[model samples]
Target chain A: MKRLTRSAQRALDRYLHTLRTCLTGSNAIDAHEVEHDVLGHIEQELSECREPIAWARLQIVLDRLGSPLMWVPEHDLPSWKQLLLRLRIGPEDWRLAYASFALWMLAVVALLAAYEPIALGALLGSFVTARAARAFGGELDQSDRSKRWLTEPALATAALVLGGAVLLSVLPAMALVSRELVEIDTLRLQFPSVYHISQRLVAVFERPVSWGWIRSALLHGGPWLLLPLGAWWLVLGGIARWRPRWFAITFSPGRPNCAARVGRLLMIAGALVIGTGVAIGLVKTLSIAI
Target chain B: MKPRKDLRPEKWTTQLRKGVLELCVLNVIATGRLYGYEIAKRLSALSEPTVREGTVYPILSRLKQEGLLEATIEASSEGPPRKYFALTAHGRRRLRHMNAAWDLLDDNLKTLRRRTAP
Candidate 1:
């Protein structure tokens, strides 16, 4: 029932823009209902506040709604569908990313359990080599926002590789220490139950410090990787902003001559293959040695 | 207590809005579907000349979603194609029911005012 203030009208308009960005559809009816509900809630709260306090209360309400920029409209569910189409993220391709992740995890577990030192070393070498190649190659040349190293193919490969490496190294050490601890404990069973020093060492191996090393590697190497990635993003952003046509031609799906798409697939495949080879080698070594 | 100068205008506007918006919207949609801009223009012509175009869309969307009205897009010879809305059979029944209720209420209020007149 309250008449919207000029500022409230402006806020609603801004919220609508982000909702449209998140969702595209012929019917904005659902989104509009949400906006009305939000605005009405603010109005109701403002009415309850003292005259002087109303303005600040209204601002607080808006702040709680978050950056009106981030409101995803319930109606605009088509945006994800559109993006998936534009990115050529077919069901098969999406399934492949999931499958690849699962395979990498399985390989890491197998290598750690088998404990073949030489093969494990080769796996690490191959993984490092693939990552280095992808890094040195123009593959990492994507923009910072676009590439997002934490989730990107290269980083995932690096993580998988590192996880395998640590597991391979420490699992054997853990087994040896555990064996020594048990032996020591049994020998001193009759005497004052003496604790084995190797038990402490084994405890150290079991700690998640192995992944800590991986995290450290990422933190150290991230910026160097991100710099080129950021530059790539800036360049891509510039292209998208100013010359969207050119950008689309180079990057959009189904373009026969689009070097960017072909380049991306080739680079990602190369990295994954190299990473997998490294993992397999590590597993083989771990299997033979231990 | 005397009201502040600024508060008086806002209070009156809110009162006017509370009284009229649903009736205004129903009247506008009585004939046929018109996109938000047209509805705002028609509402503005009835009273305040500066009706905010932004306010109408939410009401229209709400009404459509409420199943009182159905909306669809048709090609326009003008700019972009506009979303046209029409009252459903349910909406017509509801509107007719409300209109009758309002008439009875209005009649009772008038009768009460007359009997109490000084």
Candidate 2:
């Protein structure tokens, strides 16, 4: 067998890279198996030719093999996998949707574990879900118009409910559980020194406070916390309905306009300011009551 | 007058080709054990709408997974080891049934064409 020329090898590498991209996330065949088979086929063809194969000749052979996208057998996928694939935001970008959903779930778990913030988890979850829903909406646009209102709105509503549950319910429940684990008598007895230190710290920070005010504030303020997020979801859903491109632009920072960039920066700053204010209020209220 | 954009022939041919491609692939392998490129080359040579080598690998992989075909990696003098695919016992039985079905379909189609001839 004769070795390929340097230029030919480089061209083959680039071709294989594009082929690999097209074959990614394919469930029908192992990517490595296909790559190995393709490489073997190419080498077999190359070996039959004279020594020092020309780069153009190699390209011609690759072209004859056709685009790698042609080899992605969608029918080979199981029904459930196909359904999940349809949940994507773009053509051939189902992998992004899957990755984002996986990350969103991980962020949700972290929030429930009390290892992350409610706001952060809510933001991540809503962002990814919105992106995925946007992709689904795009597909819906090209599909039957009769089903558009039903499916797209339903998806947005589900996302909003999930975001609210994650923020209001899961985060608070986990925080309560974490607080109880620390405050429990049996656990406190097991860590007497730690408990004593915590008590001393609490005593130092303690201030006189009425329990009624805190209770009433929580009863009133808890529901209000969801207002900003609910409004955001409504606005997002409205944009997604009327102008999907605008919805896409709002979330996708890769090709953002100058206005979007500035808006995103301002939103981040506002979130930080609000988050800090909430943290301070919570600390002050808890110090007085606990 | 605008030319009629009749697409039924192309569409029907595409569907027909897809339907028979697997059966054709099985028949090709039944002749002898063949590597990926060999199978593709033989099929493209024998059939319409030439089968590219890349298209052959997935079908080969699917057949192998379905227990209709099995592959073995053999060391090659040229480059990487070649995965040679051959029919399993089940595959032979499937090929027999598929061949019988094809013959029946072919006979019926021939009779229909003869009857309809002007």
Candidate 3:
């Protein structure tokens, strides 16, 4: 690149800065891509310049480029509406980010609308679009204030969904694979699948499994569920510990470094839960067997 | 200011240029793959009134996003790699339609101007 006079460089910087500022929030454009193109254009235009290109010479090029403000002429909307319009229009990733937010908002509306199917569909859509936005943004952990506001709810829900499923199902999963103790089916909920899974869990260790095993496992399994559920809490704590900013963005908002302390406490609690669960499982097995 | 309600001829002309600039860009790329600067320069020379130099970059970005145009980067000795844009098959079709429309509009405007001339 040809060296530029100090004034020329400053002029170029201001121009590019203004261009980026104008472009950054446009929904129809990727600001960075345009910035790169602008730079390339300048490089080509200045290729044959003197050893140190002067501001006057550079000004001519910038003049031809026109004022950056002209590219994004202000709209005629009312002040409040114009503010909303500003948020609505932004760089390309922001479109997906806003779409995800809109879907998330719709999911909330569906919740109030008392519609389960629609709520689930919108939640799923929000989750997908949020992930797409994150992927498109090219940052796995991007948490720009604008972007996170648009995406965090969906991402948080995703964490909750996956974490909830795994945590809830782990005990039954463990029961299937682990030794049986005092199997007594209590706390009857009318879930037919629960009944079937319960019966199968009971006889699972004895013979070819039947739904009877579920009944037996249910008796001793209630306390044991804590083990895996607690471990999941610890897993999030670990994330909070390592990437506290990401933890704050995705999970909860708190002061800096709080994730570490919070995560440590969760791990300790999880360890205690695991210990208690194992001891209870072992003691119950012995007491019931004897 | 209410832009659509504004009756300034300059403002109208600017809007008109923005609309046609896309057509002009595709036409430029239709000829051959050209780098960003080169494309902007070619269109900007249409006297910078029809197309501002900086504006071409945004248009290129949009066209590429829309899949009408695609970009390739090649190494350069002076600065960063040059981003060369070319028309996709879809772009070619769109350009052909735009060109036909422009021609029809031009002929009608000419006829109208002739009829109204004192």
* TM-score, candidate number 3: 0.45
Any idea what lDDT model 2 has? 0.61
- Candidates 1 onward: DockQ, in order: 0.08, 0.37, 0.40
Write one digit per residue (lDDT tens) for candidate 3, span A1-290. 57887657766775776677667666667889988787877777888888799777887888787766566545422455447545643444378888898998999999999997998899999988887766554333223456877888997887788656644565556556443322434423445555554554454435534687555543545444556667876786677677788765544443336657766776787777777767766877798899
In model 3, what lDDT does residue A80 have? 59
**lDDT tens readout by residue for model 3, B1-118:** 6656556788678888877888988988888999888887788777456457888888888888889998889998867788889998988888999999999999999999999999
Task: Give me the displacement of residue A24 in model 2, in angstroms.
Answer: 3.8
Write the residue-wise lDDT of candidate 2 on B5-107 in tens digits: 4456765565566668789899999999889989988876776544455677767877887899999989877667788899999999999999999999999
Ranking by TM-score: 3, 2, 1
Per-residue lDDT for A1-290 in model 2, tens only? 35677656765775676566555566656667777788877877787788788766787788677666566555665666456545532244344444445555555666677876753655465455545544443322222234333333333444466534533453244334444555778768898754554443333223233676445433433323333434444444444455545644543322234334434543454455456446655776787798
Sorted into a CAPRI-style docking class, model 3 comes out as: acceptable
Stretches off by above 4 angstroms in model 3 are A72-290, B1-6, B48-50, B77-79
lDDT of 1: 0.49
User: Alpha carbon lDDT of residue A193, candidate 2?
Assistant: 59
Of candidate 1 chain A, the 10-residue stretch with the lowest lDDT total is A136-145
Error of 2 at A77 (Å): 4.4
Comparing 1 with 2 on TM-score, the higher-scoring candidate is 2
Of 1 and 3, the candidate ahead on DockQ is 3
Superior candidate under lDDT, 2 versus 3? 3
How far residue A188's Cα lies from its native spot in candidate 1, in Å, is 80
Clashing pairs in 2: A89-A135
